[model samples]
Target: MRVRDVRAYPHRVTAQLFSLEALGWDDSWRELASAYDGCGDPGRIVRVDRGLFGVATREGLVRASLGGAVLDALAKDAGAAPCTGDWCVVREWCDGPVTVEAVLPRRTAVTRAEAGGTSRGQVLAANIDVAAVVVALHPEPRLARVERLLAIAWASGARPMVVLTKADLVMDADLIAEDVRVVAPGVEVICCSTVSRRGIERLGAMSGEGRTIGLLGASGHGKSSLVNALAGAEVLAVERIRADGKGRHTSVRRELVLTPGGGSVIDTPGLRGVGLQQAETGLSSAFPDIVALAQQCHFADCGHEDEPRCAVLEAVGEGRLAVRRLDSWRALRREAASMGTRSAARRRRALGKRPRRLATRQRETRRGVGR
Candidate 1:
């Protein structure tokens, strides 16, 4: 965007405005901001309160609402919605508060199924570079959850990293991280202790300048702690969990927290319903080994179950792949596929037409879901 457009409405500038770079402002954003031609300021959303948003810009932090133009875009695609970590144009707007004219193109986005089984995708964060899947070591890492999260991270078009947190509370942190690493084909697995500060620097180094990392995990996974450790301050609050080891939801919404250094980190509340969207490419990335092995199956469309010369089954038999990992991968694949089926059905319903194979394919989807 043009410098004048970014500085639009110069009277609105305030001390609360944070450095643009800290919020991931760069040349790419300048180009998008230029579209406004001195009508609005380029801003990154830090928090969304109620239906309004709190954006950080060269003019400082301003509370804004979505304009009609962007709202129309959201009607067509959920990805176009203004989400935390999104860089948007904050217009002086018409009669009300400063409005977000439009959301610039996002390089990466983290999306999950909208809760309530609506088949709608809910974007958690946008324009992130790295996705840090934090798993605490105290209760042991759940590979199934890791695999599930990895699928989302992979689908976001960001580099996925597995961080095993609270390492000081566990005896086999490294071993557990290794187990997680087995499922993380091209991902990095780091065992970290927010208390002991283990792997803190390495994780901090992952963020700086224009780079933005997204932290995602279940509640009590120490996502807040890791963010605090990385920022060297208590930016996000944390809560003590129950004696039974279950964690209470602390963060109520997704927020973008800028590190003291540079770059930004988007923290999302614990996800109880971590559903995968149309993430076929994500499944392949998360389970590259399994996808590669499946390529060698005797049949071109082998399901890897009771099929002759099933490379996947043979690998499991030879202990080349963990049965549990493979199971989790299959589960995610099935869940993703089933979700796609449902999504397609919903789209067809919206169009007021029924496909000939809809019911048959749905039955098959149900039968294959738990297999």
Candidate 2:
């Protein structure tokens, strides 16, 4: 954390001396990297800015540009672009320019639908083990936002953990954490305060030794503070909450920082909207209590809305489940379903256009033959 500590063991603070194994590489990555044997070194994307990438390889950190193949993949699907926490192949040319040749397969990716009404999903961070959803306790926590973030975390194929930050600012932190546990169902919930250093060690342990944890939440949630606390230094800038209790966006980009214990943490900018895109399993995972109750419904397709002998509604009636929770589930379900419909329509439209495109290509081929 001190200047001497950073200077004494420079590799510990920087992206140097991190072997492939330390970066969570495995047999799968080894096999995948085999095809690119003569291409370049395998690296992990530590940051992505504009169209450039900061890749961490065995040699250390290097700024690189996207290669032609990677750019083409991005043109087809934005999600295919390299994101923080992604393992990629980096190549340096004799002309003094480094480029990302290809991105390896991702084990897990935190994704959400694009903000501007697009059915396509955007990859936030890839290859994360734990998705920490930070919720501030100062201005009253929003359970709805917690549920939405938990759903996204579940869909990412990572273990979701609810971190109640700013606990020092609130008196009833434990009580609020219990309530959040109810909504998160099977997810782990812990309350911590960077101001008082409460529960920081336990949260920090999740990123220990070859593990990767991603911080996902809105602004003013103390995510950057947590990263600084865990790293034992001011690795990132922090901002105070506005006078109106609104959050100020401090993290402008997604960056993967290597902590002291050979672990990594990916910090992302505040997400304004996390639109659900085909996250059915995630919704079920986020609301397991409701899913379990729905299993006993008399009708297999019961909508839980004014349906006869609906177990879900019955639970709500008997005070077994909260009405607002069910309403939140319904809203997320509808949003995911709506996005699914739109995504399917778009796929069908693309399929319909494919034949015409092929025909056009065939005509061009014949014209070239004639020429």
List where candidate 2 sits over 4 angstroms from the true fold: 1-15, 241-245, 354-371
Clashing pairs in 2: none
TM-score of each: 0.88, 0.90
lDDT of each: 0.84, 0.87
Q: How close is candidate 1 to the true structure, as a TM-score?
A: 0.88
Which residue runs does candidate 1 get wrong by more than 4 Å? 1-14, 93-96, 241-244, 353-371
For model 2, the run of ten residues with the poorest summed lDDT: 1-10
Candidate that scores best on lDDT: 2
Candidate 1 has its poorest 10 consecutive residues by lDDT at 1-10
- Per-structure clash totals for the candidates: 7, 0
Model 2: per-residue Cα lDDT over 1-371, one tens digit each: 12233243323234445666766877888899888998898999988888778888876677888999999998997779899999999887876678899998888999889888879988999999999999898778999999999999999998999999999998999999988988998899999999899999998899888789999998878888998988889989898647776666788889988887778889989888888854997899999999899999999999999999999999999999999999999999999999999899989998989899999999999999999
RMSD for each model, in Å, please?
A: 8.1, 4.9
